[model samples]
Target: MVEDGHFWTETNWVFIEVETDEGVVGVGEANWTVFRARTVVQALEDMERFAVGLNPFDVETLRQRMYNGNHFLHTPGVVQSMVIGAIEMACWDIMGKVTGQPVYNLLGGKVNDRIRSYTYMHYKWMPPEPPEKAAEAARHYVDKGFTAVKLDPVRPKEGPRNPRIDELEYAEAAVAAVREEVGNEADILIGTHGQLYTHSARRLAARLEPYDPLWFEEPVPPENFGELREVVDSTSIPVSTGERLLTVHQMAQAVENGVRIIQPNVGLTGLLEARKMAGIAQAHYAQVAPWMYAGPIAGAASVHLCAAIPNYLLQESLEGWNGFHNDILEDGLEWDNGDLIPPEKPGLGVEFDRSVLESYAGEYRPESS
Candidate 1:
């Protein structure tokens, strides 16, 4: 603990590298934060049983077989998604190695010529002096050439501290001030992080409507699809959610319920699983606004998924976190305007920076069993 001072709360990045008979290696990551760590790790180990000898080039067949296998672990949740994500991504990586093409080409082709990127800023880090402080930070990001920003305007809590209406009023003023500083050209995405109640979400969404946010994300918690729809129906602002949601089935329910954009975390469900989720969303005429909350490996994976999906919306990018992503991966992405261009290299377009991984070894240590 003393070496890095204190424990980093969310720095866990677990990438599984599968070695093939031809001496080729494929890499994938599993984000265990969404499920029981022990269960998720054991699931990955179990997946290895079926994956050890299979041809990694055939990604979809491998995924379907695993999905159809009548295992207790196949029930909808993070563990299954993590297992599928890890295996499918490794398979895609192997295919990229065997074919000498980037993962993007394997999943059809790029939708947009470029991937739009946004930074996730900590609202509390915005000085906390006043609403103007958040505005100042917003201007700084805009000046740095960023086209969009994401922040959780709601208090990071389970329930309301005061009258729900009062909190909404407060959040409105703060977001309004921020919008004023950043101007209309900058896109603002407000996140509720699945923390607010239905009434609270509606009020908050109504308040943010004037700011013309790109999306009012996860207004209510995602547990009930009906409530998610209720929040969506009640607000004029477009609703976006599904980062906590793991499978295609859950994504279908959200889309059917009228969610305008789907946000799938590549780390939580792996890359291909997220793509499938996006595909399902696309079929419903909904856009896919992918969720990426980790370092560069997840970020890179998200970029590939976003590129391949036809219904891709703006992507979440972690721009200002210098040297944090360098811990696990060797390469980084470039952001121009709002787009994130994943480097065109073989098999996921990057390699594990072993020295960087070692430097952040304690942070990378597996919490999953």
Candidate 2:
């Protein structure tokens, strides 16, 4: 059944453990926010047929083979990308361990020492806050030193099939309140659940422009390239998208179609393709802001990718879950003044406490339950 749309994360994940003959094991996660975790795991297991015995150092060959060997799983959605991405991440981990260098160093070293972090004000499954409370929340985040925050002032899609006049009023009030509260101390990111049609999106964009948001994210849904371009053309506010998009080709299309910021999830596109995409976007003068709402393994991988890319922008981090997320990893990441300092340790700089796999086994259960 359809429900409220927010950026709340679903925990169910497919984990990859790549073991070397030398007894070194690298960890990776393939997160599924919209699909079944077990199915992704099954897909990953199936992919082992192509992965086995391949030179772990030559990850590009295996990465290409994993994406190509399965004809039925090509480019439809996150399923194929997540499966291949998990293995690719593990490969990087292995490569880092073998080379005695951090993953970012292997990627030609860091362009940044610390990457800026951006987060949502209210996420999925949380009750919606009124305009005043929304403003207060924005203030609190700023007080905590977060220079950027994202929010969707629009009502839940499950509530209305179309935009209501009153809903427009509410949306305006929310942005107005946040803008007033934060003033110039922070950047307000207006996020749509991709619920708005072309005109409704334009209306909201025009109303919010006076407040000066960092960008308007996915005002229209991902599948509608034409509508996405329409929204981009309608606003001077730089438009951003591509979390639902998979692979270098899809992201390339989004950039060519006028998306100023490309948000690639490290768990989906993996580091290799995302690195390639970042290079591509940099040459075209666009930015790559790695989007992650998954485990710390994926987050660490994104941090490495962002560190290595010159055109890197903000990274998405789940606000409330940091404590528990960090607990699951041996050397977890932390936020300092809204920036996460990348680790210089070998590989992607994250090592999992294997016990977390058993402790959080519930996330691996079937979706039907």
Worst 10 residues of 1 by lDDT: 1-10
Number of backbone clashes in candidate 1:
2
- Listed in order, each prediction's TM-score against the native is 0.89, 0.92
lDDT of 1 by residue, 1-369 (tens): 012312233535566778899898887777554335555666777767766667786666677677766676566566777778777777778888788888888888776668887776562233234677678767867777778887776657765333356556667767887899888768988987787778777777777888899888887778799988888888778899888887777888888999988898887776767877877887888898888766566666788888888788888766632345544556656666657776688767878788867765533236533
Considering every candidate listed, which one attains the maximal TM-score?
2
- What's the true lDDT of residue 50 in model 1? 65
**Best by the lDDT measure:** 2
* Worst ten in a row by lDDT for model 2: 1-10
- Write down the TM-score for model 1: 0.89
Report the number of clashing residue pairs per model: 2, 0
Predicted structure 2: lDDT: 0.80
**Model 2, span 1-369: residue lDDT tens:** 012322335566567898877777777889754556667876777777877777778888887787776686554467778877888898899899988989999887988997888878874212256789888878877887788988888966742135778888888888898899999989999888688888888988888889899889888888878878998999889999978888888888888889989899889888888998887788789998888878778888999998898999899877733666776778777678889888888988887776975786555445565
Model 1 spans with C-alpha error above 4 angstroms: 1-9, 32-39, 123-129, 159-163, 363-369
